[model samples]
Target: MPQPTGPATAPRAPATASSPPSAPPPFPPQSGPPPQEALAPRAPVPPAVSEATRLLCVGVHHDRAFREAVLDELYVHEERFPAPSVGIDAGRVLSHAVRARNHEVGWAGGIVGLWLLGLIVSGGLLALALLGSVGLVVARWIRGSGSADTGVGLVRRAVAFYVRWLSRLYLVYLFFAVVLAALFLGGGTFSGGSGFGPGLSDPLGFARLAAFLTLLVLAGIVACVALRRGQFARVVSEELSPSRFPHAQSDPAETTAGPRLSHLRTRLRAEQHQPLVMYEEDWPFRGFGTPFHTWSLAIELRPRGEAAPVPLDNGEILRRIVPLVEALRVPSPRKDPAAAAAVIDRLRELRLDECVFLPADGLEWRNGAPYAPDAFAAHRAAALEEGGEARRHFLRIRVGGWDEELVVTVFVRVHTQGGMLMAEFAPHVLTPVRRGYRLAEREARRHRALSWPGHIAWALVHTPSSFGDSVRTLGGWLWGELRRAFAGYAGAPAEGPSAAVRELGTDEDLSLFQEMDLDRYLKTIQDRVAGGVRTALREAGWATDEFDQKIIHVANGGVYIDSAKDSAIGIGNDNKISHTPGGKGGGKK
Candidate 1:
């Protein structure tokens, strides 16, 4: 929302660490009083300008932070130059009067608009004529009545006041014209008794209506022009008035306003150069809670030039762009439990884990089916007939909080060729569970980064239990490393570089991991492991001698890992390094 602007009568005093010295005394009285005091004295010093009153003159819109900053600046000025006891504080008094006068002008314009609207329709032209004449008479009275005596520069103020309202009247005229035109055009059927539309019958009536419409349009244009011209003139005159306060400078193009606006622009321009600040659109998406997306932004202060674009890091850019891949995304718009199963099954074939799945068959096998021990034996039996890569056959279920429940029924088909698979999952019907599954899938992949080779080969799928555990353990280690690293980086804050460490560790919210480059690093590690595993499998004679096959899985931000099951017995070489399933703490096999 735009900020409000106007005169502030009571501005809060600024808090200063230390108060300044007292103000100087006022000017000494002139020698001879005499001449019955040439003309009357100006109104006993105009009210002092409060901090708020000074700000009102700027007329610039300000957000909460901006407003506070401005107030602080104002307080600094006052502290540096306090009002003296002698000849009133001229600057303070003038600023106060200027703001007050501006406020009065605003009120006067409102009053004139009200009067014109309330009386114009009922009294017609007579009312306008009366009001105009009355206004002229008052103008004359104020000009002639306020003599050089009363000492109030009241005449200049009066003139300013008059023009302020006069401009408003022109505005009202423009409004009235628009309303009249709308009514004339919209009220097409004259009255209930009229047989045809108002355009029929007497041709002269139509001519008169056309001419009246044209006149109204022309009058509106003239009123608008006059308003613009008169407003500018008033603003210029107000600014020139010796009593005016120091506020912002007016826009160069805005002849209608005073320098107060200009001052405001100057201040804003100065502030924009102060420093660079980082802001988050919102908290990163929380799993299974209110869904949100995370992205990083950087803003630079004191820009080298007027048009320089802020530079963004690579990870930050990807944070915003990686969600478009279907391979990396989940099934969506599901309706029922059955639909959810279909989606889950299809996801499995594509290696996209839409939801958690537990094997319905024996626990020793993967996805409820044990791997065949010998390809040659199976081939001779021809028991496993080849099928299209897209066919999927997997038990599908929705994953819940550390639990599972049977909701829908579906058989997913999968076909594998050239180390890639095509799969599709379909259900008999749609249900709400399907919708929930779709949403979950989408949330999981919203920021999935699939730039790695493994990502291109297979989908990365995970069960809730394993995912939570991996996140917790990996986060701890990664953060610990970062903190240890930053401890030696120079020019760092005394408290140490902890934002990176803190953010990486203990962030259960998976969205953070996606938005960051941590996943890519982890994938790199997984890729190395898979490569080493494949080399070992090639040594065994059970699989192809070539190390080209890639493993597939549904991973957060889908990816691939070569399968060891099909190649375990293919290796025939003896030169190799001993290895164990676990790394860093395990012994060689």
Candidate 2:
């Protein structure tokens, strides 16, 4: 079991002899508007507490200390990080709305068919037509011109909204449909022999039906009340949890328990001279066989009194780091360049999609500058006075192909206060709709090309193998895409570095093909980036203490350490790291 490094309660400051006592440090400055002057002021830090402890205490007020350490090492500033905006395309929403309307029409037609069957069985054709006509007219009006505003646009918006909450609506529809079916099956007025007359003989059946319908109506009214109170959306979001899509299953052996940074300060108290280390791995988007993975290692250096021989600029640091990173790239032989070349040729010949791995370039640096010191001027001044300087830099590499692009960003910062070096690696993969369609078309053609006997045999084997589940999954996937396309726009600035776009195939084009070797491609890229950084840092002699190292798993905007047995409830585990048993004592070997 992992152990705490210090006393459970906050530790007292160490006493110093000969030197005069210093005043306590002020709280860190915050950005944005100031609070109302009438609001009460914050309490002052205790004089006995050290400056470092004061900062750490404030930072870990809400979160675990280990979590804060991981975050700080990664240089993850929520204010500076560029998160992607969730916005939908208006045109796609309109198209999806039209498709949904058509589907509803087909459903109406099925109802008409059922009514025809009833007419043959019980002779209520006139009544059936009357009932069906009213439903059809109302549905048509809603899909057509029910909007007092921008008619069709309003209808489209309504359709999109309904689709977003389709899971809930589906339950209501099922209940109502079952009730209606029960009424029909119970041999009621639809049988045509019955009318509003004293000859009515099935009073009990009628009463049961009326009671069941009344209960259903009341249940629906309660559901509406909950929805009006905004409870439904909250519940759905919670049920969906971690992300919009479900996590893919993987080998259990692939996961391992490691140190969590949330307990860093406690460990630091035990071994003040030793550096703290944390690692995080992220598979940002998965479940469609995402090709890329990112891993970040954060090392927190102990504060040093002496300055470096010379101040290093971002360009010089990147120049030294690039070679180390590039050295980990997949070798030409392993990459099978010849096979990739052949695949490209075949794609061109067949008019199918192509995959092209652009020539890998050295690390490119951007946004390098001295960090703004206004927010934490006192802290900055103290670090500078002690011969340390703070700076930040962003490095990116773009790997582009015919239909896919994998972009990686390395955010590096030097913290003057702790003499810390913070590095973060973020990888994002883009797969356009055209690419997905092309893959689907390729699969269909492959199925068609199989021998008739073989195809029949394959279908026999495959049809029962989660066929219904697969169809529903695909439907859900398409629905999500359409809903996202219609989602409301955010006015925030666009996130992350921009990529150059190159048009390959038109949206109308598609071809039959097997899966691309994207996993290997992305893995190679990841290896190179991780390997290069480790090598560079080692050569610089900054990471000599191997025992203090940690690996973290970052996902869904949270950082976590790996362990043999799952420890926490809220943390994610897909990309966890392994550690030796009882390795938590300041990472001592």
Best by TM-score: 2
Candidate 2, superposed: residue stretches over 4 Å from native = 1-296, 300-417, 426-523, 535-589
TM-score of 2: 0.27
> lDDT tens digits, residues 488-566, model 2?
2122221221111111111211122211323333344444544554454454444524312443223233423232121
For all predicted structures, in order, the TM-scores are: 0.16, 0.27
**Per-prediction count of colliding residue pairs?**
54, 17
Overall lDDT per candidate, in order of appearance: 0.28, 0.29
lDDT of 1: 0.28
Model 2 Cα shift for residue 97 (angstroms): 5.9
How many backbone clashes can be found in candidate 2? 17
Worst 10 residues of 1 by lDDT: 496-505
